[model samples]
Target chain A: MSHIVVGIAEFKFAEPPHKLVTYGLGSCVAITCYAKEAIIGSMAHVLLPHAYSSSHDNEAPGKFADSAVAAMVQQMEIRDIGPSRLIAKIAGGADMFAGQFMGSDRCIGARNILAARKALDKFGIRLVAQDVGGTAGRTVEFATESGLLVVRTLRGEVKQL
Target chain B: MGSTPFLSREQVAAVEEIATIAAGQAGNALSRLLKIPIHIGVPEVANVKLSEVPALFGGLDAPAIGVLVPFQGDIEGNALLLFPEAGITELEEMLFGSSGQAEDDLRLSAFAEIGNILTGSLLTVLSSLSERVVVNLPPFLVQDMAGAILDAILGEVGTLSDEVTTLTFNLTGLEDASLVKSVLIPGSAGIELFLEAAGRLKTGR
Candidate 1:
């Protein structure tokens, strides 16, 4: 099976026997949405909660939580994966520099996590699992065949959701 | 989130000169601490898209140890010292002077001290060059994905602009040939002040 790497502020879709992976998610959120019947999966690595304005609309849509979820859902729909058949898993959104307390708005990891949840709720997509909100960076891999979301931490710890 | 370039060629050259001096000082400091000669590459200064910043030290997903020192006052920005995961063990061994593996906390502390000296030396040179007082906050250490560490720092920059002014330095002279990178990210306001000061110094105005 081949693995497609989704970089920061990016997203990708994959089918059975393929994996969608994103690396080093800190203060950023990685959301994986999978449809069992269609065997379709998509992942987004969102850098912030919201876009700055319409000017930034031309840039990567997956760079913001709101747009990322919307885009992912649209991509899945193109493949005949309906919302009713979709479940989501998330990883990353870590406060890598804790106690710095830049501010609530600057608490980007937590804000990204909250934004992803809100976006998912807006689409009525059920969040089945998540590994988020900590002080470490995480690499997430989502397999379309097994529908497994694997999370690997910088400290060499691994977990499956 | 604006795309305007922050620093001009002249400004970038000025910053590069300051970084070279700072890197020299930092190399000397490290050499003293480790009692081994340290060599630094020519400093590079550039203005780049925020998305492109994480690619400098490999990629966003590459495991790294980042030492961050935030500075405010006459200037506002962050100084980051990045060490790749493969280099950390060698660095720890060199710094602690032990063959056995050192503890995590100890390694972190050593890295923090290295960051402090490097950042402090840079800020001092910048202050002297601009004749302005720049204050550095306490240094902290984080070991994680390079992308994530950058994201945490970029959160603030994200609200301001889509591009960042960066100063980078490469270090060598270790037995293992481990690569170390030092990056200085100055906020918009800080870059403006720095450019203004640099321009004045150039024209003697």
Candidate 2:
């Protein structure tokens, strides 16, 4: 069983016995889409809510909420998995700076979370589990075979979402 | 976002010099505040992709004590001082003459104070570029993995551009250069201002 680290602004697909992980998630959100019957999964670690390209045709689609969801859906389409068969789990979007940021800066984490949810909904993927929104950082792991997402906080707290 | 690089060589060097001066002043300020010897080392400044910031610093999963100072006025930016565990211990000893840790609240304040002084000194120097720069707000202190701590700030930067300019330097005054790291993440607009200021300063205009 190998765990591939999906870096920020990047996404990857996995098969059985393979897992995807992302570390040091503060305001950045990690979105995971799993297909149970096909036993395949994809993960994206996105930095913002919207990509610069509304067409989702940019070079780095995995970097934003709307495009990451679109990228994953488009790839899954190639693998013969329909959008309805995809269930999603999301983690991160923590306010690591607390209330220290100025103006709208305070709500960046919440905004990322909302964007991820909205994108998943748009793609008709059911969001089954989520561990998000706090004052600490998190690292997440998704097991492709088990369809299990493990969200671990910096303080050593773990939640299997 | 474009194929064109965000900053040219001259621009990076100009920012590096400006940041080095500020970092040196910060070290001096910390030395005075803590009554200890402090030194500043050469800094690495560049315009880089937003996603690569955590990996460039200590790392994503490593534990760190970070102080974030967010400033706005003519330009917006974030200054972060990251202290390793060893540096924290040395700080405690400098203040109390012992390696023993202080109360949690006091320790947090001390760290926050360190950040305040660092950011304060940085702002003092940066005032040259833009007199309107305001850092009146108190700095925020956080202890967590390095990557997690940076993403919140980087997420904000992501709104402006895919690439951001960061100035990273080591506080050599500590036992090891790696003991204390300071980074300045300037807003997209700040970079242009820095280049323009650098050009002006170079020409003595």
Model 1: per-residue Cα lDDT over A36-76, one tens digit each: 88888899988889887787776677888999999988888
DockQ for candidate 2, C-alpha atoms: 0.67
Q: Which stretches of candidate 2 lie over 4 Å from their true place?
A: A53-57, A101-106, B1-3, B84-100, B131-133, B174-179, B189-193
For residues B68-105, write the lDDT of model 2, one tens digit per residue: 77677766666666665434554466665676657767
Residue B196 lDDT, candidate 1, scale 0-100: 61
| lDDT of each candidate versus the true structure | 0.78, 0.76
Per-residue lDDT of model 2, residues A26-84, tens digit only: 88899999999999999999988885444434547888888899999999999989999
Q: Which consecutive 10 residues in model 1 chain A have the weakest lDDT in total?
A: A98-107
Give the CAPRI class of candidate 2.
medium
Residue A55, model 2: Cα distance from true site in angstroms? 10
Runs with alpha carbons beyond 4 Å of true place in candidate 1? A80-82, B1-10, B31-36, B39-41, B47-55, B75-77, B88-94, B98-100, B160-163, B172-179, B186-193
Docking class of 1: medium
